[model samples]
Target: MIHTDVTEPQDFLVALGGNMPSEAGAPGDTLQAALAALAEAGADIRAVSAFYATPCFPAGAGPDYVNAAARIGAAMTPEAFLALLHRIEARFGRERVRRWGQRTLDLDLVACGDAVLPDADTFAAWRDLDPAAQMERAPETLVLPHPRLQDRAFVLVPLNDVAPEWRHPVLGRTVSEMLDALPAKSRAEVLRLP
Candidate 1:
């Protein structure tokens, strides 16, 4: 049940990532479950990117990841939305055992409304980094213009596939623009999710 007295409808960005399920769960399963969970939490998904499998950063000892990005309209603050995401992750059996380790679910509130995160706390650190740093150290903050929105082809490509017209409030760039800005090497591994 969602409490809706505190906010109005606004767009949100959610990114998903996780390695092959071991004792956790399947990537696809987690992604879909997250979608349903988000909907249940009061956000209506407006667009969803096709799943993209990519190697985890920092070269971890994990399997290839299945990732996606979603655009949603909800009546919740960024903080509330993030809290709900963690709850959904916990329901899917995710545990903080390893940094960038495999998991059954990983729903990240990559952006919220039109507000840029301005803090550097555990819940808001990435709010101040550039695009590359945000991608390199995600799960740190759900800041927007998604500090790394313009650099990670993994995110840009999927986001373009889903919402080409989506624009960054702070940078004044569209999803296509962001994708166009990624380095060639960063854009290499992404493909159209079927």
Candidate 2:
């Protein structure tokens, strides 16, 4: 939970994704409202990415997603920030139904510290993985360099929009560099909000 060494002013990235709302107004409005809620919860919003409309993951369940990223400076631990994220999502009517499924909001803690995590399973799963591996193959760890970071243009393009200079802890690639390496189809569906 205490992921960063820096205190108070550590720069952390928060990513949000949701499909266009059935209600009036732009899809990005959902993200903006969420960001404002985060701010109201006491995190400092440093910067934000433009909205990126990209095809849904796992293919075909709903329309494309409106995704965006943000940089925040907070005094709380990663766990506290995650709690705040959930609160904001609830305020905006996020429902937990399916994985990568449609929703009113989805706040992902993509990265926390400068050091990439080798364990990201829910706290309980991470602990069990180390102890239970001998009994059976534990679920794969949720290491961050996210494994999918470079491959998913939805993650990369919006990430680049906000944190182009963010360097991969292991790969040393900037967001832009990783983005450039992705296949054309990778980001082929990502369109910047006008």
Candidate 3:
């Protein structure tokens, strides 16, 4: 029988990270398995960045993290895509024990084309939150382009690998530009995993 895929595909930027071991083994191995699971769940795997070894946020909270980025083409709403990401994380033994706490897997929906998941004002407020205020809380829902995407080296460095030119719909800066804008030390902290 002749069949054609009818789902409307949209570009998606997903950030993957973890510091703890899982059923798949090491953090890096777990991430690889997560990618395969994403593909199996119907994300059209377009490109993936090399993994990077990054110091944990908050400096000395836990073990170092293995981080990476993936560019996907998928036919799903941003909310649906985010839900799928959560499901994948759950499959990999992810647990939300604490904010910024280490885990077995983290699949973050960094961006979904130029579409904003909630609205412009909420997105802007979260994106522009003061560092001190940010530590006090987390968004209750998915935030597109990730609220802190511009400030995180671990996310930006690997993102530059597969989608250096992808612009932040709200910030209007390319991934490469965002990576360059980070403080020298922050940028230096992300070492490519060999």
Per-candidate local distance difference test: 0.72, 0.71, 0.89
- Per-residue lDDT of 1-194 in model 1, one digit per residue for the tens? 76654657767788887775633357876788778888887778899888887777546677777889998887777777777788888887889776556777777666775577754253244545565554455454355555556667767877787778777766778888878887877787765556
* Tens-digit per-residue lDDT, 1-194, candidate 2: 22343466556777788885723235578888888777776678888888888887767878788988888888765666666778777777787666566887878776665645554444334433453352344224434444456667888888997889888766678889999999887777888878
lDDT of each residue in 14-124, candidate 3, tens digit only: 999999999999999999999999888878899999999999987888999999999998877777777888988999999987888889999998998887768889999
Query: Following a full C-alpha superposition, what root-mean-square deviation does model 2 have from the true structure?
Result: 6.0
RMSD of 3: 2.8
lDDT of 3: 0.89
Task: Record all residue pairs in model 3 with backbone atoms less than 3 Å apart, i.e. clashing.
Answer: none
Cα-based lDDT at residue 189, candidate 1: 79
Task: Give per-residue lDDT, candidate 3, residue 89.
Answer: 95
Q: Could you tell me the TM-score of candidate 2?
A: 0.78
Q: Model 1 — TM-score against the truth?
A: 0.80
Worst 10 residues of 2 by lDDT: 131-140
